[model samples]
Target chain A: MQNLRIPGPTPCPEEVLKAMGQQMINHRGPEMAAIMKEVAEKLKYFFQTKNDVLVLTGSGTGGLEAAAVNFLSPGDTVLSVSIGVFGERFAKIASIFGAKIIALNFEQGKAADPALVKKALTEHPEIKAVLVTHNETSTGITNDLKPLASVIKGAGKLLLVDAISSLSSINLPVDEWGCDVVVSGSQKGWMVPPGLAFISVSPEAWKANAESKMPRFYWDLAKHKASIEKGQTPWTPCVSVIVALHTALIMMEKEGMQNIFKRHQKIADFTRKGVKELGLTLLAEEKYASNTVTAIVATEGLDVKKLLKIMREEYNTVLAGGQGPLEGKIFRIGHLGWVTENDIKVTLDNLKLALPKAGFRS
Target chain B: MQNLRIPGPTPCPEEVLKAMGQQMINHRGPEMAAIMKEVAEKLKYFFQTKNDVLVLTGSGTGGLEAAAVNFLSPGDTVLSVSIGVFGERFAKIASIFGAKIIALNFEQGKAADPALVKKALTEHPEIKAVLVTHNETSTGITNDLKPLASVIKGAGKLLLVDAISSLSSINLPVDEWGCDVVVSGSQKGWMVPPGLAFISVSPEAWKANAESKMPRFYWDLAKHKASIEKGQTPWTPCVSVIVALHTALIMMEKEGMQNIFKRHQKIADFTRKGVKELGLTLLAEEKYASNTVTAIVATEGLDVKKLLKIMREEYNTVLAGGQGPLEGKIFRIGHLGWVTENDIKVTLDNLKLALPKAGFRS
Candidate 1:
């Protein structure tokens, strides 16, 4: 199989996948609880926080939903910053939970301005929380979350960050940045399959959880916290994925967090340089480009769909298309988890071969 | 590993486990969507309905939360029939969602009385829905869903059934029996590892969803339905689990639904007979015994905890223990999913060894 070039469910280490193949165990048993406790502790270490991290047996979107349901009440005003598909999804999810969302929209390939977020928070004193995406995967724009969190914190509001693709690939000190609630998934920089999602809760976020009146049960934070204190989960978790996460976290620990972040930056630099040398236009602002994935505007009049299809069918390389308004306008190449300069080279070579056949003269 | 004798995360077939180790795919891409469509279609076939089957990336409890959040609103009255741990959990989840609960409590190790449920609905006409557990794994008692559904349907009240352990092992003709909603898990009768949970909704349930004021986003029925109509999911799913589920459903189709049900019945019958020959007291009433697993009460002063530990540590055979008030009072033996007659023989032999160690003289 050609290497996966998508943002996530990126190529996982063979050892990580093998860890998931272990024999199943009863979820309510003590052994399972031990595994859960270790995962929770390791997650806190990865997030670089002393706060509690709760694991949800779902995707990163599920983690986002948990934050919404556990922190905001019906009719509560929330300021949402949207620059790409995932940013828009946060607004959509907030609306579904009956929250009155005030969305600040930006161009598809741009990042939301933290100044605009501050303006909205000041104007709407009723806004209880401000939602921002640390890394907008659709546009490959990595917003400055430290500044955004400062804006929200200065306004005396809770800050929720979607750090799904940015957690380990980029520098996100959850506590240092003052992010109230941060959501992430296992598949991205963790080098595992797409199953488990997690969120680290600050004391401020937990306080909001206490007064939140949203209807929730399985994703309820109170039950989760109570169970976590006992070294277990309120529900039966995805055991196989949890096992896989344990192995992945150990690898991360061995590499050291700072080194892992630097490695991702190096690979991202290598990929962006290669794409530029190939005469492709980067989608996001150069100063704000994401370190996990790179979005390239389709230049030289290339058929984005045809290029993606040929690469997948012939070379076995899978790339992601631009979601929402960016569809047919840009394509994304991922540089997260188990990805290296060599993998990026392979992807670029395939793109070079497929572009000519897709009507690109470059 | 000595066989998985527990109710869930039961011994999965090697092929099913290996399927989970398949290379991960980008969840937002068409490849993952195609896998999701196949899994959903197979689930629809297994559910015996043309209604939409939505999969969530969580455990069985996550599906239960989806049902409660999507169907009932805050201050809405729900009648919950509680006979065992799962039944009580249903009530707990509903209450957590701010639903006013009227519980119909039955004795432990017994099934809920259909008459009681009817009377409760008769008195409280404002009750928006009724939650019932088809098979309470905690007590090994399978309630009569048909009779209960008949009563609720006659009264035109919405019926939500937790058919987690009973879906593939027993007969639950969702449409014919007038079940408005049903929730299940992949780890149980689906013969796969824990990761995915599914729920089937009827027209009446859809109507309730339209008027429901519960705060939900990820578990929203409308969102799931809209995406399923396009043969996709709203967020990233457990792709490998979906592959395993597709393979498992194909195996189920070949076995035929009726034959699979009968097989469970035969195994359950043989187990009950063996327990009776050993002169052990059964926890569940014979008239309402579940076909999935059997709960054996500690007779002749047996140390249930010691017996369980010995079985696990020495023989590597995992047996479930009584939950809630019955903890340490009984041990459960599951015959659900991929269990053969020889498994039963091995379990019985281990029990014979454990009984004497537990200070049981016979």
Candidate 2:
């Protein structure tokens, strides 16, 4: 069997996969309502917020669009604190919906500076909301959201977070951070398939939604809120994935949040240490390194493509290559969701042999 | 096991369900590219169009939103032909996106009138598009799309179709009917789970897309078309559902379109005749009755909820309640997507007994 590892489409546990094969149920019936109620209640525990978390039947990008159009109107001034590709995507979505974005960009593999964000908000007093990514999967960097949230919320700006790749694996504490809206996907730390996106809406975000003028229907949070109150989704949801998510959540609850975090922390540490022992440079600084995925700088004269190929074909292991400008310059190892130290050990052992084969010698 | 007989979230074959449990593959890798190419080619056979059919990762309603937001600009005049709840929902989505709508509605449980649609287009000379549903699952009626398409296409108006429930089971030759845009769901006749929506876009629709001014990003078909050309979705799709769909499509191709249509026709006939023999009345007229779902009017003096309860609790058969105004007045029995004559017979047999227990002697 292949050790399938990517950032978001992480491998699911056998039980979670089996749960996805359960027969379809009536989405509007009492049974479905019961599932909805259970999933909704359990979701709050991960979000760490008392806000109503509504489930949408699309990918994480769809959830980001919902975060944008539901709270910010055309010509609304917004500050986007982008650290990597996903952070930039959040801003791009807002811009596409006509939000006048003031982009505050950090380096490719660095976290957003809260001081710069504060300065941007101070300079642009007209900014209505601040968009940030809790984890930048593209560069394997997690932002320091507590300080950033304090800066944005202190300015009374609505804080929208793209927690797609970070939520369940990392501790976000949405309520404590005063995030107005937080978006996440199921395929990441939930150990579920990629069909559902969860969004938590605070009261301030709902106030923004009422006056927001961007045209929307499918991603409208108000409709979801009204429907979810009665234990239903406004649209027909991805039923099987939701069922699988229920199983994953129950397992997660059993394991407890602190254990889940410690597990990811340990695996991420092992991966980083293994790469360093191989004499490779890490992409992100250790302070901002993400606990879900690890990125390593491609060694000089090493064909990253060949290394990845050898890993996939010869080792039965799959890893992610850098995206966009970082392509061929770095490779990513995903250690999130259902991953263990043994999986990381096998990958590192195979990589040790494959590196030299790909012209990397130390 | 519960018999899920809703119009959507239809029951899948065991193999298809097993396919959904396959381990995750890299969505951007060569393996996923192969699945995308195969599923894309097979989907054209179902859509019956040379147009590029893009698979989205949301429910059918999201597909409808894509069809409208991609082709129609805000302030654009559009004629919406409504026969049921879903038809009205199409218009509602358009209106929500700021399209000026001229509604031409038919009676409940009836199909759209081609003459009225033509008249409406004539009256509204500025009408840029005509939105209609091929099969109204809410009322169990299938509109005569050929005539409606002829009217709209003859007038040089863009023809957008919601074929969510009738695409594979009932014939909808998109290209032959000159359909500009067609939307469908996987949960219906595709015999897959409820996470994917497929849309076929014609060249003329692409032309309209260039000028569509409604602000959109996630549901933008242009982005989908660009990414699908590279054998990738613009977003992380519901990967498991796509895997399931590949299996479902292969089975469909083996059965052949003619055989699939005939199978649905036989079961629908059996269901209608059985319902009538049980001294019940079908909601839809014979000429426009859908071949997927059969709607029966709740007999007077009998509690429709009680009948549904008896069917569910005693026979383990779950039926669909009516939507909007039809709620409590009609119950729907879905016969699409892996359903058999035996399944319908069992539902009918149970209904015969359920009616008397719910206080209906006849």
Candidate 3:
């Protein structure tokens, strides 16, 4: 019953949750269209894009798939920069689409070199798109998408960014940043439950959709665009989530995007400072740290499982451990969405008490 | 607003709606796993299939795509029987995956003939799968899936049924009817909000998945199955909808599946008899009438639009118009899910008054 401190499904505001609990409406009705139109406009404002924003009913991974399937064709070469688990997921998903994947793997907690991505594009002029995860949630590292976008723009290829965990918390100018396609989810910084995923597609990406041949139907961008033009989706959407998203977007607008971003930065900085005061080593480089979450490396052979268990059972706080190869080596504390400085302080306080119980000297 | 009485997105039970309003939870946590396990088990009972049922965070169309992309490879042949709008969607989606489609077209108000499907399959032995809509909401026609299953079984090809509007309201024995893949949605007979799509896959469908060359990531059946084995999903699901589904399934079990189907049939029969008594003509033949919804043709040139408008504004009843080619030609009355005999009687009473206002002779 305690607050959700782990990355998303972050703690949604009571008003937003209650908005979803409202009576269900007919999806094809005009009432639903009003909500959809309002949410779509507000999302465009948040994404900083003049182009259409299409909402799909799925997770962040679904948004990633939509970006790939909508732009790249089978046998097309795609360069993916793998900084952590999500970046690797992008590579895996692209390969599943039969895209010739050219992955630029970096260290676990390090950012990918944009220069390497440029070199890959130079080596393979056949590459149609370069994929990057803007914020690698697994390691709490934020890759410099601007630099990567510069590299991609220089090559005249498309730039696709997975901004799932960093969209609202981080400063992403989809148009000004020269990104072709940016995908985000509702559960992360949007402070909504998991169900809706969105993508802001540039004109160039829309052009790419016409020729892409990776086989798509429900996720087809062209169909989605056509439906959006008429203020509808190709099929029924998650009306409850859409209503919740409309409320969340209105809240975001009232808070101001810049202010929200700065609040996330402040909380993340406070969390990092608090953890350092506890003498713990952060996972990623300070310069490349993400504002949404912070990954902490377990030092002195600490029992991470016991630490996480104590945090959950005793303090009633649920923190996430590293995924895939980094599992048990580190744990993550998410300070995104509705989280505040007090939340960060409380989590740090829990860590202060629970670490020693797990045989860690703090 | 008023209640949703359309075919899909029927009025959700109060408990189910409140369940979706529950606080969000981490999708990867133990609590989520427990809910998912219970949901999967209950779904098996409703589907009458011991086979695993995977839930996707999309609409019913997304579930259909999951079956298409996960089972049939590019250049694979599929026989799609199109009796109404949704059937054509099946063929179109299959073709999007590069499946060689053999569409067997039927009149709008008629059910697809199993003999025709047998003939098509006999002619096209290369067809990897047979796609059919169990209940065509557009035409209010329900195909005899049992006989169609025999044809598909004799052809030794996989059968994929779109039971989105029919499941739980009609008799669909996955094992007895020999359906290899059956797709349903939460908005339909499940009495939940629109978001989650459920699909039951047989071992035979799994075998097809092994060799499927279609590109897929988010709709990967194997990934869902692997995660479901651990009582998890590969990605975050529509958590609120899952909560709603869990609550709805509990209620469904208490009512019992047989009684649920019979209740729908009773409502359908009552509505049909009432419409006939009012001198209205039903769209589909009586033998092939759909239990979920009743489509009534606007005989004697009744203004379908005005009728629907009057019913909505005057009576607060939301009736569905015909889709695709039949648009504005008929009005559909849904009798599925939480719909009762009194609901049907009230709808009939409204139609009797609204018909005259729309300039109908009756």
Candidate 4:
């Protein structure tokens, strides 16, 4: 296997992978109930919330859709705070679902400014909700969500957060932050493969659900909540991934969330320092850099495609290229889940060697 | 492991299970592209469709929702044909999405009559589409889809099918049957775990999609189609499941569809016959019995719950109980995907022994 360094779909542990290979079981039976009950409880530690963290079988985008449709209806005004591609994606999902969007976009590599978000809300007093991404994986910027959450919650509007790539690595306590809905996926810091997405809904979000009138059935959060309470899922779940998640959660519980967060922070700091030492420029604003993934801007005359190709083909190291407008202008290295500092050392070492070959000059 | 006999989530082959344990790879990279291309091509063989087969990362219900949302707008009249629980589910999904449903109901253990469907469409000329369930796992009754497709398509209406429990196990040639859209799940006859759903769309469905005005984003078929053509999915797909599916599909190709269908047929026949000899009555009408799952009626004075428990606890044999109104009134034996005559024999032997212990005099 190549040294995979994408933001999500991070490498899983051997125990988790082996757990995924177990035989299929009756999803509605006692066996499934035990797994669901245990997994749901343990997820509270990762989410750091007392709210109901219902699991759905899909990618992170599905969880974002669930968050949007369950809280706001057509023509309802929503302030979408965008820092990068994923932040913009949450806004696009809301717009597609009929929410009138007031987009508050920051610069590509900077986090959302809480004051600007407050100004947008004041300008559009009709805004019923605010969408925020805790981490923008595309540009490797981690939004300072506490102050943003405080501003949105102070305005008494629903706060839905896309914590897809940040929840397990970053320290965002859902209840402490007063986030009404937080959406995440299994492929990120959860140390599992992609299949399941999780959503933690506050009591305030449930209140929104009662009156929200966007057309949805499969992505219904209320149905997932009810079924999860019964130790069941409304639809047939991805049993193998859930099994894997259970194992991953157990491992997480053993390591503790605080330690996991510290490990990510340490590795990310090491990566950023190493990249600078190698004469590379970081894409993200220094203070707001993400702990899960680090983005490096391609200098002029440097072949970003050739750089990625060389890393992947010659060294068997894979990294993510920028999405949308940032495509071919930046590349990302993921340090989430099971990554270690030594892994970062090897990656940066490889980059130092490959940089010259890809036409990068000091 | 215990004998897992559910309609869907049938046991995978050892190779497929091991494949599910593979490490994560970049979903947008060439490795994933290769997997997607091969899986998409081989899926056409199973779907028996010349149309574009798109892969979506969700369960069968998500696929059904995709099928409905893509082809019809709000208040557009749709003829929803129902024989059992899953049939009703498809209509519920369409109804939730704001389609005006003209439900054509058939008796619970019976197949949908083509004549009745034709009559409903004739009476409801405003109906733009007809929803059919090729196999109803809840009642172990497979609809006679070819004739029903003929009647619905003859009227120039789109025919959307829920083949969740049938598909590869029983044959429904998408092109020949004129199925405008066919939805299936990975947990069924695919011999893989749940988490992915396959949808095949014909030219007629795409035309309908152009005019269809339903609020959707994550379940968007157009986005999925565009991305799939480039050997990618609209969302970060369930990588491990897709890897396992590749292995499962390879096994299927080697076995061939004809032989697979025949195997399901033979095992189903053995299960039905074995149940009859054990003095349990089948719930399905004789001619419409499903090859995937076999539902047996709970005889009077028999403790159905106790019977299932005895079978599970003593024999390590798991089976499905009925759903909705049929709950506790029937028990089902699944014979789809990786099942054999000997497996059926073992399950039957357990049931025969457990039936008496649960107060079934015979």
Candidate 5:
């Protein structure tokens, strides 16, 4: 079987896969209530926070919307710091909900600059909130979130984070970073399939939810909190995904989140160095590179499409293409979740042979 | 193992369960695109509409939100016809999003009266839309949607239907009924697990979409339409569920939609007869009875909780407890999706033996 090297829908272990096949259960029964409670607690533990971690039955984008719609009101000024497409998406979600967005974006292949963010917040004193992406999957850069959080927290504005690709793969302690709202998805380092989105809300975030006037229903966290207290969701949950996530969490705890994060860092470092050995420069600079995915700049005269085609067709290794403005300029290889060193060995070995056919000569 | 009969999250067949555990694939890659295109077409066929059908990575409740948010603007007058709790929830969702709702509820255990709906629409000429539930799981009543749709359509008002528990288990042709938007989920008659919601939007719905002013991002159907044209969801979908859904659709088509509807009807009829033979009176009247779930009144002096407990603990058969006002007054038995005669026989056989223990002296 080919190694599916995408950022979010990473390969799940056999045990995790088997859990998905479990029979459907009563989402409103005692079994689901127990599972829900345990899943929420384990997620909070994994997030390294005591905040109220909520499991949502949508994608990471939905969780991002949940973060924005619950906290920001119409005409409420917010500073949105962007490093790549996902960062831009967080701003777009807020803007769609009527927030006045002061978008401060960085170039591709770079991380968000906290100095610029501080300056923006200083100038836009009307801003009540700040949105930042912890890791930009498209750019393969993990922003230094703590400094940005400190800036927003120091200003007394709420700090909301899109940790969709970072949390479990790296060291993003939600409570320690002072993030008022942090959103993540199950298809990342959770080693589970896509479907469930998770978010943790701080007291400050709940305060914002009380008066925020952006129209919402399904994404409303207040209803979620109330229903969860009764051991139920506001709606029928995606039970099978929860079943899979419940099992995946057990695996994560067994491996230990610390070791899982370190394994990701080690594999990512190896991928970057191995790609460099094949004469492909990395997209994100070494200092700020993400440990979950490695973005590599395709060499001049080498067709990115051709490179991907050869890699998939002959080498049977799939990778992610650049998104938005970064399209055709770089390609990404994911190395998170249950990704193995042996898988990387196969990927790098394939790259060594496949690069020549794409007109790479060095 | 228990035979779970909880309206939704019904027991899936072995083949369907096996598909849920399949390996993950790149959600944005070509393989996923092909699967998405096929899924949409089959959903359109199953919905029996030439209109656009969209698949979302959320639950049935999320799909209901999608219907309200996409068609109604804030302050728009809407006539919400309620039969049970889910009906009330649709109105609640619309109300939450700022719609001025004129909730016209029928007596419990009865379907929406077409005459009353007509009168409400006539009196409230400013009502821009009408909301109705196709199947009320709590009361086990499926409204006669055709006449209601005719009245709303004749008035040139938009018609939105929450068919979450009804669509595939029975017949409600989208175009024939002139429904602007109809929402269903995978956990019910689709014979799959939860986590996937399907929605169909009519051309008339698109007309309403242009003027609707509900603030939406994650559940926005416009972005979904744009993205799906290229065979991708605006956000990452529940990949494994989609894989399961794809397999389930194949099985569904093989059985044929008409036959599947007949199967649900037959099982539901058998369940009602079996319950009646045990001296139980159905909550819903015979004419408006739901062909998915059958709600039976709890015997006088019988504790519904004790009945449910005995059936579950001793007999290993899980039945749905009455919801909302029906609590302690009724119990519901589901016969949708992959249910067979033997499954229902086991449940009814267990119920016959267990009811007397809960103080049903007869």
Candidate 6:
């Protein structure tokens, strides 16, 4: 199989994959009750939160929308911090749901500045909510959420986070950070396939849900929470994926979350050093580089797409090219979720050989 | 494993289950593009619509919300026809999105009346849309969609269908019936696990997309359809379920749509006959009884929950208890997707033995 290296749909382990193939069981039965309770508990542990972490049968984007719609009403002012594509998406979904957005834009490859976020919030004191991306996958940047969360929470505003690509791969102590609503997906560092997404909602967020008036049904967190209390979901879930997630969570628990974070950090460091060996510049600055994925600025005179194509076709290693404005300017190497040291080495080896063919000279 | 006879999450075959366990892949890569395109084509075949059927990473409820939000704007006048719980959900979601609902209520256990629907539309001349469920799983009544479709079409109003439990098991030709938006899910006759939902949007619906004023983001059909044209979803999909769906669809094709429909019909007939032989009354009127799920009135003096518990604990069979107002009054037997003569016989055999134990003498 090719080394399928994408920021979100990372490789799942064989055991977890096998678990997904298990037959579908009664979703509203006794077994499901046990599974759901265990899953919610483990998810809380992974998120480092005493709050409820609810699972929804949708993608990460769906989870983001849940956080947005559940806590903020239509026309509620939101100070949105954007660093890249996924970061900007938080603001976009909120805006579509009628939240008045005060977008505090940052450079593509740079992390969000806490000072700038503070300035924006201060200027727009009416902004009831603060939206930030903990990990910007498009740019491979992980924001320093601790300080940002302090600013938002200290101001007594609701702090919502998009942790889709960061949660399990990095150290994100959600409750310690005072994040009111934290959203995540299964595909990034969960060692599972894409489908199910989760969001941790605090008591303050539930209060917001009581007052929020934006039009919603499927992404309604209130419905999901009530059903969870009853050991059911508001709707039929993707049972197979949830079971797979249960399996993946078991393995993750055995590995220990701290050790998982440390492994990712080490692999990310190795990948960055290897990319620098090829004379390629990192898109994200050193301190803020994401452990789940490493973004490299394409070498001068190199077609990023061609570089990826060459690696995929010749070396059976698939890498993601840049999205949006960064297209053809950067390529991302995912080293999360069941990735080994050898996997990173294989990707770098392919890049070293393919860069020369893409007309790069070093 | 018990015979899981839920209306939607029916038992899946072994091959489809095995396919779900397959390894993950690069969703943005060429292989996914091919798989997505093929799935879309096959979905169109199953939906019997030349129109684009968008696949979403959510449940059947999400698909229903998509139909409501994508077509009718907030405060638009909608004539919502309801027979039971699932039917009322259509109106409920639309109402949540701020649609002005003109609820035309029907008796439970009976199909929607075409003449009544026509009269309601005629009486409410300003009705811009009509909402109906093709199969009301709550009461196990399958509405005759052809006449209802004719009435809605003749009135030149958008006809949104919640075909969650009906589409593949029973035939309701989408294009021929002029269903502006027809929605379904993965857990039904597709013989796959829940996690994804499908919606076929007609050209008229796309025109509605231009004028829709309801707040929406994740349930946006336009975004889903635009991405599907490029062989992708707007968000990360349930990859494992999609692959399993691909496998299930292959088996379905080998059996052929006509034969699949016949099998469901025969199973429904056998299940209903078995219930009758046991001196149980069917909840749905004979003419409109659903071929996918059979709702039977609980035997006299029997506790529905106790009956279900007895079936599950003692007989190793799980049957759905009544929902909504039918709770404690009726129970349902599901026979859709991969069900055979043996499966039906087993469920009936268990029911026959368990009824007396639950205080019903039959």
Poorly placed runs, candidate 4 (over 4 Å): none
Residue by residue across A1-362, what tens digits does model 3's lDDT show?
67567788898898888988887777777778888888889888888889889999889999999998889988998888889999989888888888999878999989878878878888888988889999999999999888888889889998989999999889998989888999999899998889989998999988898888787888888888888766688899988989998888889899999999999989999999998999899999999999999999999767888988899889988888889999989999988988889988888898899999987876
Per-model TM-score on C-alpha atoms: 0.95, 0.99, 0.98, 0.99, 0.98, 0.99
- Give lDDT tens digits, candidate 2, residues B1-362: 78888898899999999999888888887788899989999999999999999999999999999999899888999999999899999999999999999989899988888888888888889999999999999999999999999999999999999999999999999999999999999999999999999999999999999989887888988999999888899899999999999999999999999899999999999989998998889999988999999998987566788888889899899998889999999999999999999998888878878888898868
Tens-place lDDT digits, model 2, residues A203-302? 9989999999987899999999999988899999999999999999999999999999999999999989998998999999899999998988887677
**In model 1, which runs have C-alpha deviations exceeding 4 angstroms?**
B28-30
Off by over 4 Å in 5: none
Chain B structural similarity as TM-score, candidate 4: 0.99
lDDT of 6 at A2: 78
Q: Kindly report which residue pairs in candidate 6 clash with one another.
A: A238-B194
Distance from true location, Cα of B239 in model 5, Å = 0.9
Question: Could you give candidate 4's per-residue lDDT for residues A1-362 as a string of tens digits?
Answer: 67898898898889999999999999998999999999999998789999999999999999999999888999999999999888889999999889999989998999999999989888889999999999999999999999999999999999999999999999999999899999999999999999999999999899999999998899888888889988999999999999999999989989989999999999999999999998889999999999999999999567889999999999889988989999999999999998999888989989988989999995
Please report how far candidate 3 places residue A70 from its true position, in Å.
0.8
> Among these predicted structures, which one has the highest DockQ?
4
Cα RMSD (angstroms) for every candidate in the order listed: 2.1, 1.1, 1.4, 0.8, 1.3, 1.0
DockQ, cand. 4:
0.89
Error of 3 at A40 (Å): 0.7
Between candidates 4 and 5, the DockQ winner: 4
Residue clash pairs of candidate 5: none
User: Across residues A1-362, which tens digit of lDDT does each residue of candidate 5 receive?
Assistant: 87888898988888888889999988888888998999989999989999999989999999999999998899999988999899889999899889999999898988888889989988989999999999899999999888889988999999999999988889998988888999999999889999988999999889888988987788889989998876689888888888888898898899898899889888998898898888888989789999999998877566788888899889889988888887888899998888988899999999888888987885
- List the candidate 6 regions with Cα displacement exceeding 4 Å: none
Query: Global lDDT of each model?
Result: 0.87, 0.92, 0.89, 0.92, 0.90, 0.89
Winner on DockQ (2 vs 4): 4
Q: Model 2 has how many clashing residue pairs?
A: 0
Better of 5 and 6 by lDDT: 5
Residue B116 C-alpha lDDT in model 1: 88
